[model samples]
Target: MRTRRLIIGVIIALIVIIGAGFAFGALHKTKTNAKTVTLGIMPGGKQEDAIWKVVKANAKKSYGIDLQFVNFTDGDQPNKALASHDIDLNAFQHYAYLKSWNQSNHGDLVAIGDTIITPIHLYSTQYKSVDALPDGATIAIPNDLTNESRALHVLKNAGLITLNSSQGLQATVKDVKSNPKHLVIKEVDASQGPRTLPSVAAAVINYNFAQSAKIPASDSIFVEPFNADSHQWVNIIVANKKDRNKQIYKDIVSAYNSENVKATIEKEYPDGGEKAAWDLKF
Candidate 1:
């Protein structure tokens, strides 16, 4: 009887331990499954939606991450959303744009992953070519600092204007030391560049905006070079400085930098509008 009692006690203890182990595992699994993240993106056209679906599905299947997207129509909102903790990450702006935003807002957002490079182009509906631009002709550029500087660079490269080299990426219309064409560079909201085309002789437009406006790649008079330096304009997945190294964020980056996503980008924007930043190092 003593031996039987001892056996029963041992069995009861083993059962309790096993039950606790199972419950603990279940709790851990629930915690792991609950992991999710929200990313902000500028609302591109249908292509953007399709690509996001692919990303979302991929992340869900591979990492069990519940990836969510918050779309912003305004170029300025994504970073602001991220800064305010409204979104966990944003995959919209390039390094130059992000840098300018941080400096202006006194924010500490950092890029955790590189995504793509959308070449900025000079598009004109009135003038078929750069040479056709007349003296004192109006040209619209992005109002934001980084893009305004970039637009000036594009204009400088096109020989329509020249900029102070020392100003570099910070160059503005004021840095235009020479405008032989007497071009009137108008600063407008970046999203307004394509819309302003009807009123201006030409406009330096970001690829996404141009695409959104249904502007064709062939309509561009000048396309920014896709080289080493141009990689600085590659769009990135930005996170708050403190969250930069989290494993979930790293997984998100890995998911974005995958071949499936790269292939989708190439397929969606085959006209050189959006080039995947596959070569970019994180």
Candidate 2:
């Protein structure tokens, strides 16, 4: 009876050990199986919503992984979050802005894929067209360096002002050599440009902001010329330089640039959709 009891004890111990091993194996599997990636977006608007919807759905279906989107209200926030390792990836900034951030901040951010080019437009409530603006009309523009230069370029393009020889792409209000309209250009945050339109004689706004405010691109008094130079304004998918070769990184770009996604963009964006979308060469 003692021997029998000893054998039973041995069996019970083995069972316990085996069960613990299985539980550990299960935990390991769970850790490996939880495949998820997060994407940081600009904000919650129809344009952003449409892009996320197609990209997220395709990412899940094609890669058998989950894609999460976190929304930020302004352009500068995502880069800070990325540098802090708060997110896996972000897709809200144009290449020009991204380059400037990387140069200034010593960030390791890498652009894996180029996304859409959100054209900038000069919208006005007090004027029918850029030509109709009276002399000394006030114009509100984004205060950031990159956008401020672009805004000045738009005004120059409209024959309202000209930049000095020393004034380059980084030019500001001080660079305006000749203001034909005597336009008092006011620099404000890009996100607030939409709301300031009714107050300012005219406001130059990024496409996404205008879309969020329900302002159609066609209604803008002046829109940026769509040319090769404008391609720099295209948004890009960004991740840490270390994650550039990860499978999920490649999958995200694939999902976003797929034929289905292209079709959706074509159908939605006023631009010809995928083929004509002002994105980088795949």
Candidate 3:
């Protein structure tokens, strides 16, 4: 009977050990098989959307990632969704817009990869060039805070206006100390910038919006120069601050900055409407 009791005890110990090992293996497999990543995007451009379709297919084939997208029409929804963890990532905003969103929402989102610069341009139907506009002519610009300053800076750079130094990146039309042409600065929604053209003497338009409206590159009198002042305009892939260093996130960045993606950008925008910014130091 004593020998039988000792044998029973040994069997019970073995069973418990085996069960523990199997449980750990299951957990490891669960983590290894985790693949689905949902991303949020602002749906505006047909070409841009097609480009993302390519990324989705490549990510699945190359890394076994189940990349999914959540499209948002409103400009403000993506970051809010990301902050709530409703989506794992986003690639719609430039650094300046991201900074503005963070400040307004008190959120801690972070940029994981540099993508491209979809530059702002001053477009006109009536005026041939910057110098061609008559004095006191109406000009349109984006009304949003950061872009208002950016659009104004574009005009300043083109020698149409002089903004006071005090306003920094938050300048408005009121901050224009010198409008040499006495140009009436019209404030409109960023998306509406292109539509105001030919009505106003000119409008400063974002590249994606301009593309959607079928505005030709020849219509632009001034393209934002690729320099230190436009550093914040470089677009980026963003994630929640806590997920900044995740391996999967880094993998996405690598795929986006690949030669294949670079080739696609060059093919799509041969007119130089957008510039690949991953290799750029700034």
Taken over the whole model, the C-alpha lDDT of each candidate is 0.86, 0.80, 0.87
| Candidate that beats the other on lDDT, 1 or 3, i.e. the better one | 3
Q: Of the pair 1 and 3, which is ahead by TM-score?
A: 3
Candidate 1 positional error at 35, Å: 3.6
Where is model 3 poorest over a 10-residue stretch in terms of lDDT? 44-53
User: Which is better, 2 or 3, measured by TM-score?
Assistant: 3
* Runs with alpha carbons beyond 4 Å of true place in candidate 2: 1-34, 71-77, 134-137, 164-167, 180-182, 188-201, 208-219, 266-282
Error (Å) of candidate 1 at residue 19 is: 3.9
Provide the global lDDT of candidate 3 against the true structure: 0.87
Per-residue CA lDDT of candidate 1, range 1-282, in tens? Answer: 999999999999999999999999999989977978999998777987878888888888888899999989998899999999999999988888888789989999999988888788999887788999999999999998778878888887788887787876688788999998888889999998888998999999987788779997777988887654366688899999999999999889888888899889989978977877867542
The candidate that wins on lDDT is: 3
Off by over 4 Å in 1: 1-17, 29-34, 71-81, 84-86, 131-138, 188-192, 195-200, 227-232, 280-282
lDDT of 2 at 106: 90
Query: Could you give the candidate ranking by lDDT, starting with the highest?
Result: 3, 1, 2
Local accuracy of candidate 2 as per-residue lDDT tens digits, 26-85: 999989887899888877557558867988899888887799988898778888898788
Clashes of 1: 0
Instruction: Using lDDT as the measure, name the better of candidate 1 and candidate 2.
Output: 1
For model 3, the stretches where C-alpha displacement exceeds 4 angstroms are 1-31
lDDT, candidate 3, 234-282, per-residue tens: 9899999999999888888777787778788888778887788898764
Model 2 TM-score?
A: 0.71
